[model samples]
Target: MLISRFELSVARRQLLHNRGQTLLTLGVVATSVTLIVFLATLIGGLQRRIIGDTTSMIPHVVVSAPERLPLAPWELPSATAPAAPLFVGRVVKLEQRLRKIEDWPAVVARLRELMPGGVAARVAVAEGQGVVSRESNRKPVTLVGAVPAEFTRVVDLQSNLAAGRYLGLNGGEAVIGYKLAADLNLRLGDRVRVLSSEAVSADFLVAGIVDTGIAVIDRSSLFLNLKDAQSLLNLGSAVTRIGLRLDDVFDASRQRERLEQYLPYEINDWMRDNQRVLSGIRAQNDSSRMIIVFTVLASGLAVASIMVMSVTRKIQEIGILKAIGAKSRQILVIFALQGLAVCAAGAALGCAVGWVLCDALGRIEVVVSATGRTAQLFPVANEPFYYGLAAGLAVVSGVLASLYPAWSASRVDPIHVIRGQ
Candidate 1:
């Protein structure tokens, strides 16, 4: 106990004797630790928001036909001469598009079974192109047909409505995207004409306007009753796709593989479907890692430089202690303990500063371009693990930096270090 106390006392005295160098070393360590904590918190928050926004915009897995192609005609039109004055040329043959998925309920049931939870919701959907017109304004949109209740479980359609209630599939009501409505100057209860490629036109009451916070979806898609879409597209009880939402979105690939046995359609997982957004998140992660590496390296260099200077200045004192019966191990412990003390102090101060910086970041608004949304405040993850991780890194850096200096101090020769001649 006496030896330990003596070693600690010497370490404290040495730090106090060179207060400027000690403080500078501490500041460098603190700055490195602060950057680590700040980057981790910011990146973690950004990842969550990005993933959540992207996932909510689409289903975890989508089962659909690979392509919509023209089917072979059952019977060729007769080459008989036209009986009317308007029919002067050959008759046009009708070609049917083959893309509808039959018996989707069985496939959906099998998919739900393959998921972690058997309660995962799957919805049937049919898609086609149509022109939405409100007076002179007309724009092309992708029309999606879905059952309202089932669709709500597959995506956040009901919760993100900007105006009016969600479509109940009754009274021929339809839901339009906010951007589409804005372009058409449409309002709730307003009537709009939607025409399909088959020249099927109908007046639908605008029941709701949804702002999904995604530019593409909001500007190019709208929703209608499944029955209405089937009728308009002349599809008899057939759906074009099945959307499944899982409890854990990361399991989409596994679930898709399992679902392959139940259906022959192409299965697209969310990760593959939103590769661009995921790539952005990955890029941010890579940049943060690079920053952390440089910060840690800089901190280690500062610690090493300060420790080397401290050992040089204390060489005579170390020689005196050795001549007075101090062991090399004792001298080593003194320097190591000094390094640990510096790390502890710096880590504590860095954590406090990091917290303040994170709080400030949380108050600033960030506009996510990919999502086409502006967050009121930046999201910050304040988990205790981040601080613990920063402290651990600081400890490792301090110990590694102090080793050479501590070894040099232990190897001091009394004869050479103490000679006045």
Candidate 2:
């Protein structure tokens, strides 16, 4: 029901009469909302930064040759099972082999056609395990070979370069991770010998040092020109896999599914490969939401308790109103209006304070790594949606908290209160 001017006047008078208590309750509600807004923004921005850092050095999706599986004699149509006279024995496992995608250039072209605007970059990579040595120091590393320009589009290697320059289009030039360079005591222009698993060896000048923040990549990875890697790995004209970067990283899984339907090769997405990281992010979000919920509930309970006390203290006024021509519904509306005013004021104050705090914190930067990589410690997200959400929660909490107390005030007995009972 709509509140009349008389009910609004009564509500205003009651709150003014107990100005201290009203102000205290408003402060509590405001503080709760402020906490909610700050936490939500901080957590959201943190999750974004973490996901960006993790996905920056990796391909969103990878397309490769399907895995090779060994078949038993009975499982293969060409092999006839021996007559059951001999003792049963398990089939010997086949030697592990590096599978290469056949006709990968055409496959890459097909991927681009299928994805259209979705595909940002598609680069074929020749990868293999090898050992790199500078003088006496030797370290085992994963050798990756691709066109520098194309590979950088897939994985942002150029932006993460710590020293020197990225791979040139010429042979005998290599880019090594900063950790690997450190381990081997190597520097730019230092000639290092790399021996592939196939025993093919080559000497390359350390052209670049990249610090990707990912331990695995930074510790033991090497990059070379596509032809050089192919020669070292003995892959001839074939590549180990094709990596695709999407316009939106989160679309990797959906695109992977679509690609699987269109192509016969094995397709994998970052989401599938990084299940643990995604789980951690999900947990962080859930925890932040729970914290906000509890904060709002606590504020609601505080409002409810204060309203209940107000109802107790105003029994005589309620009885007098009931004794006169005032309706029980008017008494209820007056009390509810008091709650709405307090919550509305508090929510507005809270939103203002929260925004200021977030803005101040966002300006402060912190060094996140030894390589001079810096980031905002708070990274407060200033989205209006979060502010609206916090205010909405507070207002709803206030309305619900006022309900029972308003009903109790409306039920005060005129005769009993008149007798001072």
lDDT of 2 by residue, 209-326 (tens): 8888888898999999999999999999999999999988889999999999999999999999988989999999899989998998999999999999989999999999999978
For candidate 2, what is the TM-score?
Answer: 0.79
Q: Which stretches of candidate 1 lie over 4 Å from their true place?
A: 1-19, 43-55, 66-98, 117-121, 147-154, 165-171, 196-203, 225-238, 246-258, 273-284, 366-373, 376-389, 415-421
Clashes of 1: 0
The weakest ten consecutive residues by lDDT in model 1 span 68-77
Clashing pairs in 2: none
**Steric clash pairs (candidate 1):** none
On the 0 to 100 scale, the lDDT of residue 298 in model 2 is: 96
Root-mean-square deviation of candidate 2: 4.4
TM values, all candidates:
0.77, 0.79
Candidate 1 structure, TM-score to reference: 0.77
